[model samples]
Target: MISNIMTMVRKELIDAARDKRSVMAGLYYAIGTPLMMCGMFMLLIGQMTSPEDLNIKIENSDNAPDLVKYLSSKGITHGDSQSTNDKGDQLDVKDIRLVISDDYAAQMAKGLSAEITLIADNSNEKLQKSIRRLERNLQTYSAEMGSLRLIARGIDPRVVQPIKVNVEDEATADSKGGVILGVATMTMIYAVFISGMNLAIDTSAGERERNSLALLLSHPVSTRNIVLAKVFSVTVFAMIGLLLTLIMSKISYAFVPWQELGFTVTISTEFILLMLLIGLPIALMAASLQLFVSFMAKSFKEAQSYLTLVLIVPMMLSMAASYNIAPDTLQWLPVSGQQQALIAFIKGREIPMLQLLLSSVTTLIIAIGLTLGMEKSLKSEKIVFGL
Candidate 1:
């Protein structure tokens, strides 16, 4: 059995190597995707840190001298103009500013509310939060001023507010880390699955379509050996892709200003090893599933269609899991569990060894089951024969 498996593995490698398309697909999957993802993550982190300078236009500066002073004290630069640059702009300020009309004080004194136009660049989501902060601060300042005026007029400020409440987050550091890592984990899964798909399909369905499967099957080799050989080759390529991604991610992280962000992300050696240990099983399972599906198809194009459907499973699961539906019973789910685990590891959490064992075992069991089923299909003349 060992000898037959070895022979099958050798044949699969030779065939894969000779096919330039298959070789290129493997290289791209194993190396290209990871590097791309690393670049993406770096960009995301950088944006989170030092956002672009916002150009803000504040109109009707005469009515809200206090508000203008407040904005100045916060070091938020703004221009006083009705039409700063663009009218269609969402916020009246480029970053976070409000424009008061020329008749603002007259309208307010007549028991009428005045209109404040805000122009902002909505493209930067981070800027929106800053705008909200500025607005909240202004609101508080206005309320405090009104309260002092009422007190001076012999009125109690407490009469206006019957209740007060404060909210706080009691979540642990791991849980908070989990939230950010979850997004990244989902992204990594996407990169790996997409990058690995073509290789998986070509290694199996492409081989069958080129009449290579028939030649391989005719040899004195067990079907299990053939499947294992193909899986191993595909996994090798997948690892290369994943490694390239990690290296790129590390480079991007290194270039980021960690002190400015108030937190450091040091990708440790141990983390990489653990990631590989977890990612390997996922790649094997993905490749095996694709290979099994490809074996059922008559042509490479048909196999490609089937593989595409298979790709959606991971993506859908990733999208759903990204919302972090919480680490409850659903955390034990296949793709969901893997997503949770990867996030837990990335955020410096000590993952439960049992969870990793269970996930790995479950994935391998499914892959082996599928591979065995494919073996049975291969032995049948009806399925193996081109009908």
Candidate 2:
């Protein structure tokens, strides 16, 4: 049986080698992540940071020229929506309107509470940070004026404050941006699924469509051996893709300016080695899963569609793990559990060996279950002969 499986695997590998493009056909983002991901990450970091020149509509600038000048000093300036530049391009204007009270600075001269109304669509997600920034600046200006008033009256401004709060971050630089790294790890783990999908589909449905499956089945071999051979071949191809993904990550990660984003990510040799070792079971499960789905379809295109939808299960699981969502439950799930373990390792935290072992066992069991299913299905005339 072993010899039969090896022979079948050798033939399939040779066929795959003859068509390199189909064999290396990538999953999606991870495959093209060499340089594109770096640029994408740069954009993400920049967008997440607070903008420098905050522009908004000032309704009554004449009422408080002092406050308007203070705001302008902080780069918060009035902007008209219809304003244009030298090249006739529209200016970057926010829809926010800041309306000062019509008291003409009387409240401030009388040492009374001043009123400033900020108007904008609070529901606009893009303006949330900007609005908060404006509110903080206004509070700072109010506090400063109050402090001056207290000094003029021979009182200390600190007398009114009872407690001060300070927070210190204790996370190491390596572990600062864990969520981003988790997604990066997810992309690497997913390499196994997409890398072998084409070959898995071709080996099963493509064989049936070409009338070669029946001929292969007629040979002096058990269905178990055939199924095992297909799984092995696909797993091998998938691992190759995974290894390539790690290499690309190791190469491409250096180009990203992680320090500028207040974090650090290093794709060390140890991480690459560990990722490959961890990805083996995932590759097996992915291979068996893909082959099992492929054998159930009537055509290559139909199998492609089925597997595309089916792969979303693992993707969502990994994404949840990446974002640290529902970790208490996901930490025990199959794909997500293994991913959490990987993320922990990356963060320099001790791996939960027991959970990882249990997750690996469950993953292997799933692989075995799917492999047995493929064996049983390959014996059916409806599947093998397309009846």
Candidate 3:
């Protein structure tokens, strides 16, 4: 029986390998997604890390020369629409406008409150960080001037500062990198599903359509052995795709400027091994599920449609884990559970062994159930021939 299953597995693999559609489906995602993800991370990191100088329009600067000097010292400077940096590169000027009220320095002589108007589109996402920095510096200058005034009147400046706030961050560098890793991890997890999808459908629905499934089943092998063979073949293809994805990610991710985000994300060898270990059961479940769904469909086109919809289930689970949408229940669920454990491992946290074990067992059980169902369904002429 085992020999029959092995022979069936070899046959299925060779057949899938020769199918251009099946081979290309895994190749594209395994090779392409990591490079694409690397490019996206580079773009995001560039935006998050500011250049040495931040240029914006500052009107009526003479009204507060001291304030202007303070801002300049902090790398915030006034620039016209057409401004170039020392490198002769055109400066990317922010649209923020800071208008210093023209009171002719009269408010300072009387120790009274001064005013400044900042104009910009508050709803603009790109301008939010710059606007906040400008506001913070202005507040600092105001507080300093107020302290001088209190001292001049023989009052302690400390009287106004009744409370002092200090923050201590306890997060490790790995934990900080977790925010960036969320999406990266999601793409890797989905590799198992994507890499074997076309092959799973082809080996089942495509085989049936070509009048080959009936021939194969008519052989001296038990239906269970045939089901196991198909599942094993698809699972092997899925694992290979997953391994390639991890290798590509490891190579490509090194070029990203993770330091700009105040952390680093090195896909360590240990993490790679852990990911593979966890992914095996997921690959099996994916193969079994896809094969079962494909066998239930009458034709190749019908199977393709069904699998597309079926793929959404894993995607949703992965998405929820990535965005942290529903952590409480997802931590115990199948795909999401493994995802959370992977994320935890990436962040240098201890692996949640219980959850990992539970999820792996659950995933294998699902695969077994699906394989058995497919085996039972294969005996029915109506299901096998789509009559």
Q: Distance from true position, residue 383, model 2, in Å? A: 1.6
lDDT of 3 by residue, 119-171 (tens): 99999999998899989988988899999999999999999999866778876
Rank ordering of all candidates by TM-score, starting from the highest: 3, 2, 1
Off by over 4 Å in 1: 29-35, 46-57, 72-138, 154-156, 169-179, 190-192, 257-261
C-alpha lDDT of all candidate models, in order: 0.68, 0.86, 0.89
Q: What CA RMSD would you report for each candidate?
A: 5.1, 3.2, 2.5
* lDDT score for residue 187 of model 1: 56
Highest-scoring model, TM-score: 3
- 1-387 in candidate 1: lDDT tens per residue? 877666666766676677777667656654555455556656665776554434465666778776777766664546544434355544344544577888777765663555677666667886777677567766776677667767977999988877766778676444543544566566556555655567777767777777777887898777778788877767766666666566665565565544444555556677667667778887787778887888888778988887888779877777677777655744666667777776766665677566667767787888788878877888877556645
Per-residue CA lDDT of candidate 2, range 1-387, in tens?
688888999998888767666565953434586456667777766665545678899987988998899999998999898877568978899889999988748888899987889998999999998899899999989888888999999998888756655778786555547767787888888898888889999999999999999998998889999999999999998988888888888888888888776765778999889888888999999999999999999998999999999999999999999988999888888889899998888777899888888888889999999999999998888999877
The predicted structure with the larger TM-score, 1 or 3, is: 3
Q: Pick the candidate with the highest lDDT.
A: 3
The better candidate by TM-score, 2 or 3, is 3
Question: Model 3 clash pairs?
Answer: none
